[model samples]
Target: MNTSELDLRELLSFKPRGGAISFLGQRMYLTDLFSHGLQQMELCRTLGPEITQSIIVRAGFSKGWLVAERIKRQMPDAWAEARKGKLGPLLCSMYGFGEVLSSQRRDGIQATPLVETYFISLYEAEQHLRMHGLSNVPVCWEQIGFASGYVSNLEGRTVYFIEDECQAKGDSYCHLRGNYLEKWGAEITPYLPVYSGICNETVAAQLADVLRSDEALPRNMQDKINLSLKLTSIEDGYPVSNSYAMRSLLEMAINVAKVPTSVLITGESGVGKEKLVQYIHKNSPRSDKPLVAINCGALNETLLENELFGHVRGAFTGADCSKSGLIEAADGGTLFLDEVAELSPATQVKLLRVLQEKEVRRLGDTETNHVDVRIISATNKSLEAAVEAGEFRQDLYYRLKVIELNIPPLRERTEDILPLSRYFLMKFNQELGKNHTGFHYKTADLLLSHNWPGNVRELVNAIERAVVLSAGPQIMPEDLPHEIRDTLCLPSVAGDIRALHEVEKDYILAVLEKLDNNKTQAAEKLGMSLATLYRKLKEYGALQIAICSWLYSIAAILPGV
Candidate 1:
């Protein structure tokens, strides 16, 4: 099985005698496999590379498991002999990967394969030649995974490969080194994503690794940790959050769901207020009934009134027939009135009556319809200001604000930027079918520095655009939108009036953001030791409240700061 002694004819002897080319009891046409591989490439391009890589590695692991079982049953002694630096290259070659030019066995526990003429490399090279810019990260994921799976199962341990040199990345050949899970701890943590699909470790462990490596120190690190716990504890379909501010709000929302009190959600547009509404309704006692939602701001006063309180025949100019309104439809459930601040003063009087009487009077109807419904309203504007300005009804506002939840904007919760970025990336990976692993260091820098005026919705759009336009693998700074990059790269001349300490703070934060908030990485990047970075972060109160609060305070006072 060793590359030096690999016998092609003998390896071919394992091929079954059948109509279609069969290898080790499995039959398939070369074209079929090749066609499937091509289809996977297309899916990767569409879905984002992260998902595609995960699927490929998982498929390779399953194949390796089957091969091990078959070989163990047919030739138990052969399995043991193959362990002496034989199985990896033999299986790799038989599966049409390439010739393993050489392999180094270490302590009979791990294997390193140096492959030439590899199929993955050849395919990538040809694709890049055709497209002129298709190449990015290593393209030989399945091959590397197959070797790791074969060895891991044979040795009864967790083993995986990291492709250090790849032809796709412009290397001449592919080089993969395998090791046990703990063997490369911390050193190969970034590459550990390759094992995510097959590793036996629980999700908590994986998440812990993310938080440890990419530290997002919030107002309190423990509070951030508590937020992570809340994130995992919530029911499905909730917008994933890592910021203490958001998570604390979610915790309150869940508690409020236990009561029948009216709730008003306030936040910036695109902050997922409707999602919060849905979460509250789904967790409430009325979850069995429909949860209706409407945007009051999108309708004229007449249309809004008709929509909320229903209309009988001939009630309005366009009324063709009688219809029940959103409130009646949500009789036993919850009605979410989004942008409730936009309700006209006249409409507000009607809403107040409905909230007070628990009955809705349909326009042109003689009798009011009694209903049991919990009201949940939301707005992106300040209802308080609206009340003071005499635009919103103070009585209705009080009725709606029985339990208020304010969702923090994205920029304020800077700790959430990376987590939300990954969440959206994964979402696009599944929805679009592109195989994107993650952002490049510089790209992360740009993401953190950009002042996101559009909040979470804007972040989602940016990630989607980047994923679609990015060539492959990691997203580089150039892959990002010009606005994001331009905003972050503002020129600073030597004559700039900023103080040295202020300049140092900005640079330190920039480095930390680029490094995904890892203090260690930030320290090294800034040519300072870990202690010094911690001391500086403590002094500036950046580490105390994460980064935004401190930075925003300075920016506000500095008049373009």
Candidate 2:
């Protein structure tokens, strides 16, 4: 069988190499999209990951038309359907068509109403639109961004009037609120009294001028209120998380500020468990003291003890000179013991003695040294289980775990995933001198869908690799390592089996498109509450094009079916 040609035998037994070779099966442009967002495809131009980068470059080097043609052959239904719209949702929806353990409430096995159309993906809708063969970028594209301004009372109600003017043409709409309001009609009359009240052309013009006042609104907002928005200013910033878990962790750290109690941080490695420990120390009385970290797993009993406590002159063969230990080094600060579960029984005793006696003894020194050090130990495993199995000392466990700060794993705390991914992305982007702005929605969804077993550490490595291989302004899916492709994509692999909302909001929006933005109508049709529909749409991230897609989908499908 020729390597390029498909052969049954090779496809059957092929065990893709875990590093970058597993991506041998992925489509080229989709892969590059990942690489672009990841910044790895760009890195490949300088220092490439040949196995993965080569496939993406070789595949995407051609224009998209050819790629679309090939996609057409392999996935004809996708092509035929996309021909009716665009292939984007067909592709982009796959990013979230996986097993993601989100905080979204799942209502099991609801029957779909044959009378209603659901939100399909924008990419999918685009594919169906593209099937029409108008593939060139439109002469002009417009975006109507909908964002809520800071809480402000409008008219009589303390209501937030949704800003749906074009981000690029905000200024154009500065003179046209009446026109926009009239376009929406009586439905919005209660929200904006100006729209409900009768006004002449002159009066309407004055209102537009007032709303678009140069002295009042920012220059950027005034300039593009009418034109659809450009890509979000999400323009390549570090992602930061502000969720309850992080808040709880910060609160816990603050609560332990006055005491010198030992803090044992338990969580999967690379989940910022160490950082959480640092936060605790900084908030503690020992904020000014140095934080000395020792990885117990990397050292044995003797070395671990020596590292933890100082040694006297000639205590061990390598002890040529007397020196202060980590505990002494962190005299006024905190001592962070990483991988505490890996400590030996003998080391545990020494550590326990430090806690109980408030002093540590050097290996060879006859005198015991008293030091003021806050002990903060972290482990990737459960200390309780370790103590029960006699792998760890129970007394030591109890001492170190006085304040157990359990850092929730990345999977458990889903909210932090994107921000953390962007944090690593931005860091790698700058350090590597690449201009990768951000991950596309599809790739972002992929990142969110992944069950990060390796936690933040694995995400960091993936971003670093993407930065190393990135080609342009964004990181795309293909730039990810084979481990991500093979392991993390486990959720997407069971695509059709995923719940309605779990498939990401992109697809949900596409389904909503079948309904034309009517929440009440769509809800009545979907057999869910209007509130539930709105909440789910936002939660699934389907709100962006959900209403429009629903309109377009209904126009297309309702006519046909």
Candidate 3:
């Protein structure tokens, strides 16, 4: 069949029971586009870009070569059409690689025809852009290899396709030019090893061996991979811990869970006080019982009273029926009062009475009901400060803080950043149907560097947003929220204010380091002249003798000197 007559849909088939899918009578299965990107990312990360490119190119060559052979065997007429430079682009487009915008051949130029093909919306380039951002060179390695393989098989001579322009490098489109290897000469030497070296099978086997043996990887990388797996395996709805502080806090929580005394959790807002409460409740003596929770700050005085101590029928104008309060509903379980500091003085008295008497008296009801419930109060504000200010009762503060547990803010537990990020990545991946493998290295750096002013809740929102925006196998820095991506990696001088000169010296050195010690660039960025920067560095005793000598020579040549 001619290329124009081929029907792509008719050549593929699948069974409803899901045994196997067939494409052109060959067994095939669909794969997520991001899966290939993930493999590329991991291979590049572990093996370096050069080797990974070679492997991917060779694999694509093998695939294209096999497909050419299949076409020759199944339809000899189509093979003739392919030899005319008509079928390759059609096949490529039909297989969903991309749309070939144009294809042209000049047969009279040489013994072998010279072919030029321009493709838009190439999946390879899109994948590269998504995974690694813009690259410095052409990144459509597989597409080049495929074209070379297909053309070489058809012409019975070695042919090479060089991608002169690629979208991966921020080009408008990918442009491939193909000709005999001898015609390109030295231009193709760098890629010759990819085609002439060990066969694709050997490379595949070696890669498989390397991947199967954890000993082959560096120790730190192995640890990172193991940590990732461990994070992924954690059960959902449980608090994730990586920092020693958080782990120790969890141990404390578990120890305190066995006790039935009232516990107060203290932390900044969004520091996961509720999660700590859930952890305590799950591990407590009343594990099978209900865990009722309420945000006292969400309700005013009367509503808070009604919610805390259920109102009987005709208790108020809106109270048409009697309803159980959170304390009564949490009988034989735990009651979590979030933002307990927001409770009014009257509600605090009633809650203090409930704690002291172990009985809750519903509104407008004479008889009280005895309830057995553990009180777990949480407040972002300092109850001590509030009690001192007379805004809160001292007795109620002491009653709620029988055994206080304080959770450190996320910034203080920096080690938990990646673990929590991975946890949320896995969570949102499942929730959003994404296949993101992990964060890009730069993205991880940004996440670690962020102050996390909003704590874990901010991190959760960031990860969920990244998962929604990321188009690659890994999350990139651009996918992160702007505030996070823009977080400066400055040395924190939170409490101790240093002298102005010391701060200036640190900032200058930091800029120099960030620019890889390029003093000129650092000076430009620091908004100072080279001589001025040199003088500052010399004053700080930071200039090496070689730099000092160079500066002296430059000074000698200047008019001012």
Candidate 4:
């Protein structure tokens, strides 16, 4: 029961029956740190930082209290040992919060002692760096709350911890100074309500209600839809996706990542092909190695060749020194060939040789160097069409297309539009220092209705522009670009307005077609019962056609439909 003898294995237990994990005999679950950070960012976007911080802090406080109470009941000696100030930091490190570098107690003006602790390599700060980049304010709210709760319970009085310096705000280490309530009066008054718990409970209840409301996506669907891809750039991490299409695409990409085969990603420009490539590389075995990317379309034949195949000294005019190509640099890792379809025939031949032989020969050099790398190429253009047109090498096309991942356009995945918009809104709000709550209802309608020809990139630009130009608390219609705003203002041809039922029929049919005549899924997405969808289709004189299409689709899969 001694704190020094505590082991993590003894404190943690797993029960596979219900897929439950327990820490200190209390239910616990593991989660990805990056995903946790994205959730925190989302909470901040919806509830504002103050409320989100309160919620996280209160949750941490509750956890700390539970742990303390459990230890006091199971190991009274350990509870007594905690009063000497050795147990809290040891337990914190044991629980993977961070490593405590130093801890000390100092005499204060009041009767209560002041506890000062310094921690390094905390997970919260690391997650912030990965997701939101550098923050201006301290962001260890949960750790601060946990320390306060643990210490307060030991002290048998209200104690609070103030984060004097935090790694999230670019501090070298996190410094937490704690003391009894009266000892640090006035400076801690504003945060006292959070520790008092009543106000935060109300805010958390309101948040729960909002999450469970009819306007929100179903809880199970939300879990399935909340997918993210961590990126190299701190500011540009993942596009939040709510579409089944994107989810299935990502699942395929992950499965394809297990091997070292060449992959070709095809999609419209700005559809996040590069992001998908990054996701694959990150999940691959060579994740710890470099991921070097080059745009074949950005460079001419000569430059692209030199970039991909490097050169020896004096290989060309002004070539003073030998250099390794991106392919060479990416040895034991991944080389991302963006816009691979734009590679000239000569460059394509050279790239094909590299893929086939796993070696790259420098320009003006007879010898070739071996490279162990995975090739992940992306293109907005169709390589198959290019091969048919004799604009690209057929052999190279086959080599690159060992596995293909095609991202659907934004217009085709309407379910993800609003989620992506809100994600971009949150991102730019931090970058632009704005406090826009969300899109106006009318503005949201305009966004969902637009075709988004430029795809995800266009949405990012639009949201950034709206965040900058928005004058009200929420993004209004006027804040959007002219093209997006004019969507609602466009006039019908001949000034003829269609009947509401006719328009509804057209929309329902469009949804069914988009889903490949999958009526069950279409109904779920459209928020209608299957029976009601059938009735509507019958009224529109399309029920028989829908049934035939469904049967045809089934016939293509099964031996008999």
Candidate 5:
């Protein structure tokens, strides 16, 4: 029976496991993503297959119904991705947040009093999820995109299409053996309500079309990328991916608290090199004493020395009062020199004397003062290169590199993007009193795809900008600044083509594997012309392998198949 054109009121015989649940007027579901076969494998396979489930769940995104508003209002505390698309059972492991809605019926009549999206509470959402007793997608972002999508409004509608496809799977065999595809199962989820009433099918479809449009490129350009930013561990509330490394470095600094060795922290300009310096000071034994910090690159020789060491009365023109330098203030504590590489020769000599003699002679004074202080310096440049080029002193370079730590760029730690994104979201929301729940799923992908040249600093600035600009419960793609907007559309900027190709390849392979080698779906997702995809597949000789892999996987995961 062709149910597509019939009014839902005429035939209400459909029965999916978790009957249609909705929030407001948006329609969506909670799919039993894990068929009986996969459950058996997960229970039985040890290292046998950790990647399979992640792959299966990821296939949910290929056909999702994403609605930008309701998903945001319903799960204000959820990840941004969820707000835009209605995905399958959210893989919390890598779940970015979202809600699902589906139409429900109690009688034989298929027509509803009216199609509606239903509001669900946080507690109820939690309870409903708990009762399912199913695992979420893998924690990794790559895995989440594969395991299951954070489906929302339009994304949910797409999934219904997928459901249609899945139910139709056996139809092909019907021609040969007269066997029909069985209705495996189905489900429904809740949606959030908006003041302007529910999003109609037409508008929802239009929105989806826009989201998939290439014009979204203003947010994806490469040249406009900033190159400085620290990989911050915590800002608003989200934890960055390299939290472990940053923490380990802090612990190392603490371990050497008693030693007076100079510590050099190298990273991009805005990568929080200075912040890490502070972390070292706070963790060191000199925590009780004053800690002074100066940017060596920001001042001239005479001013720099006077800034680091005290000046005698009438020593210089601005010697209005005999004043103590930052060094004097941090007596018995620690002195942090930022951009230490920028220090001129004259300033370098004075700093070297302070470190070596543990004494300082105030300007124009014959007498010298003895002091004890630890020195912690930071620089974003390559000190070794500077030393070789005769720009920085050999002695100072030797001293600083004694204990060096290098901070990895954000692109190097893609796993952390979502976590840090959320951290910023929660923080800005609380600080500004906005009720933004999180990003749209596409936003998460956008962040991952971006080349954060400015590092951790850039993320903070972007989040702050987005927070101030947004007035709604969710941060839409438009909420992001032009830089991030361009990032999603442009090709990878931070890395070379090789890396980009690898990432793209992995994404395609993972999706294909998840869809059980469904060529049509895979082709749609590869964002390629079918001929191009087929030619490339033929060139790589991946066509046969992909099909074989998919069949084997399905045979292994499906029960009694």
Candidate 6:
């Protein structure tokens, strides 16, 4: 696998049979080109560019480490001495990061390669063209982090790569600078925010100092609720879910957990569908056994088949050793397939067989093995819609949906938002050693009012960011992420230019009518007391009927009218 022996064709080639591309023992799946860009755009708009960049950089850094490890194992001698300079071009080719026109060692440090076709640069350039200057920085944090991570492991030192210029920032060509961190000292401090999970020690210390000046207050009601819910949340590894809808869902999950039926958990991404699956797994009879989870969407069909069902040593190219699949690992437990809707039709047919027979046949294996395992699959997409479109198998959909649980989105469960926020705030405060008590009133109002498109995941990220940035005891609106803070705190019906009293009357009447004039049910839905509902109804001249109905119920119960 050394540079001289590396076959470029073997490194990256499309498989005619599977329509999948192989890269470094991994499968490359394809999607709409603009889909990823659009997602990044939305993340930046919601979490702000800096936070999103940090997230992307962290992801790239992890990926780079994995690739570095793979290359080292495959080419031990080539990795031992860094002279080959072939790994960069190989990675660039595989990842569409551009060609390394030239790379050299300089003063015992590796020089940043002159990339001729930087993928991220072109992506950002097109994004800016479409958005007309939506980005302000290099917009290449992931690429920079990837280069730094790969080189740092290869060189056996802490290396850093900085995007010195980017086409997104109006530069003609995206250029980068690289060196060991010790060689650059504070020179690279400006780029720290783009890197994820690296807190500046000085800033954290300053925050700790400020916290010491604040009073150690007793736990209030909200604090108590947060503390209790946070403890349970941590215990179960679930997010804070205190709303009626979530509670009912949990109750149903608990009841269904007693059975060995296949379960399908559906929700938008980041609503913690996996967490609910875990909750069910823990409460089930198979709690003591392994709970294996695989993301069907992350792997292409070839790799996915090899992973889920495993293979013999001669299964395919690079299958040097016999491997057991996740199904075997979860023989007596549960297997959760995240993004199960993304399973290729071929894989779906094979999975359907497993569900029907409770047995798995490994690739290139002559025999099938019986396994006792529960299947709990989750997906963000509508599996029914996919099935209707013939993208997903109808039988598999019905098999997985024997017991379905649709977790409500965060907007519908607004009561949980504040508790969840405070829980995350407290959780991060402990992690960061901050004494932040709670959100400011305005900040709380903003959180309550804004629609969290990303749901609990987004809220958690916002709290973590606020925790990291807050310099005071309270998290102010300024400390929140821009999307939340920038929201206009107008009335709910901002477009309806009606008087406040009239609006209230209309809303109350609508609720009562929706409930068939059942004042108790209307009061419960409105989050008000029966007396309050009666008073509002009386003021609106709609109480007499409700009063007569109540009297009629009492008279009937007493056998007198």
Cα RMSD (angstroms) for every candidate in the order listed: 20.7, 20.7, 21.3, 22.5, 18.8, 28.4
Candidate 6 whole-model C-alpha lDDT, 0 to 1: 0.70
- TM accuracy, model 3: 0.52
lDDT at 246 for candidate 4?
A: 90
Residues 367-416 of candidate 4 have per-residue lDDT tens digits of: 99999989999998988899999999999999999999999999898777
Checking candidate 4 for backbone clashes, the offending pairs are none
Residue-level lDDT of model 6, residues 1-561, one tens digit each, is: 234334333244343334454455444666543777788889989999778888877666656655675565333434444434556656755576654445554554333332223333445455555666744667776677777767666665656677766778777666666676666667678876666433223223433333222212211211100112232462355566767799889889989989889999999988989889999999899999999999998999999998899998887888889899999999999999999999998999989989999999999888899989899999989999998998999999999999999988998887787778877887887888876666654466578668999998999899999989976555767788889876644334322244677546656765664465787898998899999988887786556645555555577679545
> Which candidate model has the greater TM-score, 2 or 6?
2
Candidate 4: which stretches are off by over 4 Å? 1-237, 489-561
Best by lDDT: 3
Better of 3 and 6 by lDDT: 3
Give candidate 6's total backbone clashes.
Answer: 0
TM-score of 1: 0.49
TM-scores of all candidate predictions against the true structure: 0.49, 0.50, 0.52, 0.48, 0.52, 0.48
lDDT of each: 0.68, 0.51, 0.76, 0.75, 0.51, 0.70
Give lDDT tens digits, candidate 3, residues 120-239.
989989988887899889988888888877776776666777788999898998999888776776777887776655333443344443332322222121001111233353423465
- Index of the highest-TM-score prediction: 3
Per-residue accuracy of model 1 over 359-471 as CA lDDT, tens digit each: 99999888899988899999989999999998888899999999899988887876677667766776786689766655643465467667888988889899999889876
Residue 324, candidate 2: Cα error in Å is 1.7
The TM-score between candidate 2 and the true structure equals: 0.50
Error of 5 at 558 (Å): 48
